[model samples]
Target: MDAKTFKVEDTKNGTDHMLPMSDVLHALFLQRHNDTGEEQYVFRREGKKGHLVDVRDSVKKVRDKSDLSFTVHDLRRSFITCAEGLDISPYTLKKLLNHKATGDVTSGYLVITAERLRAAMQQITDAILQHAEIEKTTLIQRDNL
Candidate 1:
């Protein structure tokens, strides 16, 4: 929430991550924050501290509404594939996804910058929008600006 960035203080992997929110995600987060920022999790069950463990029902509802048959993991794979299509460096994409680089020697020296990750994320977002036939909106923050 610092300026245009969002901080993930803790994760299941026991690591904290910070990401600059793309405009579309920022708007979605803003709406969620306004609706339920008081809760511990953005999409938590009512009266629960933990997030909704099983979003299958909700995902099904969305899938039914959109008439798109896909599991939640499909969305993750689509994001990764689109980002890869842009020729985003594997290291950058891995960093964006919070994956540990174990065997790569150069990854030990390369520091992935927020700017680079933001650019990669934007590319992925743009690709998704294009694929979905959604018009690009000014809601997404651009680094060029």
Candidate 2:
């Protein structure tokens, strides 16, 4: 993974993609990197794959503890809903979700940059944080990036 982007090797479409990290995510990743040292995978395990392949058990544990029932796809849906509610451009949202334009001529002509995606990501993050009542002052400011 790069400092600003996280690479997804096993995507649903079997194609790799790089996702720009939001400010909060970037900070969290940096902290994790510092604690774990340089490793091939961010979330490692002593398994055959040498990394976490399935998180169902972990999710179940969290659900058991917190009584919050949600699948990983729910989080993705929430993100899309949030981005739509914010009126984020469709192309940007598609890029963030790593979805192909799929015969959209205009989308084919568009080239969304990492910087633009980062800004959009930060906006989405800020919106989510705000909805969660997290204090803005406590977060890493977007200008700092």
Candidate 3:
């Protein structure tokens, strides 16, 4: 991952997209990189893809431990709902989700930069963290590391 953005392979579209990272994400990714060293994939595992593809088992374990009922798609849906609630631009949200604006001519004309996406991502992340009752000071302290 770059300091501000990460490249993700969109399996649905068979394309790669660069998505901005929020400050919290940047910190977390930096820590992960440090722990894993220079690996081809950030979240590598002994899998067919050599990286985390299906998280169902992990999610199931978490669900069993915490008694939480949710799926991976639920998280995506929640993110989209949160982004929409935060009034992030439709195009930016689409880009964030790595969704192509098929049949939309207007979307083709818009150029959303990494910086812009970073700002949007930070905003959404902040809102989500705040709603989750995570203190801002805790995030600030993490960013310092």
Candidate 4:
């Protein structure tokens, strides 16, 4: 595929950001699109044209049912920590998080490539899978680690 992407708009910084979607993300989004083909919003209220204004209660409900004790922000922190552990370049990570670069002279000259970003994303995915003891169809035998 040539440059598959999804975008988020109206950020706190007053900018629209577009991000390339990885294969798995693309698949998930495609599924959502298909499921909500006739709807104006993918996760809308009943008979509404817009999406739900808040998903915190839904997230909390699920969190309460699970053994994991983490807020949505915790997941964000975990993702960043895992990506850093995989040695992703700070620039790439910043871009992934849609964070503005600091006033570093070198950051101005850096042009991050899609291929490099994809590689970093894949590494992060692999790392997450490994952490969950999931690889392919089998749970990685913990003793092997």
Candidate 5:
């Protein structure tokens, strides 16, 4: 990667708890390494490791949502499960996602068409959904972090 210009990472949603990519990848890679000894990437928690936050103190709490069931993290799990299908450039994913860092001044310097980026993201989304045995989710609805 060239250089990072963003201030705080993963605060795009104003979300109180944004899980780090490292934790997700570490657990995922561990799942792979358990079978094959070859190492992929080592994952470690990023800044402010486990700063205290409570589930009840969420930005938006879903009462009907299952406690042991689908919390917001499940959406993230679904994302990683999908992104892993191919080596997605994190930069591209970041740009495609309106994750505050969207205006990174690198590739973000260029004004990309929603259609083009949307297509690329859609392809990834389809591949990811397919990999997870999930049918595709439609694009008519606005998508974000």
Candidate 6:
């Protein structure tokens, strides 16, 4: 509806109980389950920054429920698709995805700042949750299928 926005405090956590991205990845890397005896996820503490988590695990649940197949990259692609389905433009998408429009490798190497990326991601997140305001139920929002 309104232009997507987020405040700096949007990501703030409590002083006593806080769960950062690093902590989640750390647990996913070295931690194993006691009952199921399976690792929750595969991650490395020293891996490249912003490298997406192994989404296969989450996608597997979707595949089983839907009786279909898909890949992790498909998830990212679907985000763009959902935005486009709402008539979001390619130029806007380039901004939303924090990608450079210039094709020249040398000249087009303009860096996408983290602030811009976060803002773009917030746009998608806000759009996805917008419909939650429609229904009269306890559900906050639905996940991508």
By TM-score, who's the top model here?
2
**What's model 5's lDDT at 54?**
42
Tens-digit lDDT track for model 3 on 97-129? 888799999998998988889998999999899
TM-score of 2: 0.85
Could you tell me how far off, in angstroms, the CA of residue 120 lies in candidate 1 after the best superposition? 1.1
| Least accurate 10 contiguous residues by lDDT in model 3 | 136-145
What's the count of clashing pairs in each model shown? 1, 0, 0, 0, 1, 0
TM accuracy, model 3: 0.84
Error of 3 at 102 (Å): 1.5
1 against 5, candidate with superior lDDT: 1
- Model 3 superposed RMSD (Cα): 3.2
TM-score-wise, the better of 4 and 5 is 4
lDDT of 6 by residue, 1-145 (tens): 0122222222223222212222222232233223223433233222344323455665787899989887856766977876777665565566554355677564355565535554455455556546435321223222310
lDDT of 4: 0.71
The weakest ten consecutive residues by lDDT in model 4 span 136-145
**Model 1 pairs whose backbones collide:** 23-140
Reference-based lDDT, residue 45, model 6: 22
Q: Model 4, range 54-87, lDDT digits (tens) per residue?
A: 6687687778877567787787798899999888
In order of TM-score, best first, we have 2, 3, 1, 4, 6, 5
lDDT of 5: 0.44
Residue-wise lDDT of candidate 2 within 80-131, one digit each (tens)? 9999999999999999998988989999888899999998899899899999
lDDT of 5 at 116: 47
Q: For residues 39-138, what per-residue lDDT tens digits would candidate 1 score against the true structure?
A: 7566776566777667788898899988989986798788888988899999998888778889889999998888888888878887888888876553
Q: Name the regions of candidate 4 deviating beyond 4 angstroms.
A: 40-47, 65-67, 135-145
Best by lDDT: 2
Model 6 error, position 83 (Å): 3.8
Between the candidate structures 1 and 4, which one is better when assessed by lDDT? 1
Kindly report which residue stretches of model 5 are placed more than 4 angstroms away from their true locations once superposed. 1-68, 102-105, 134-145
> Between candidates 2 and 6, which one is better according to TM-score?
2
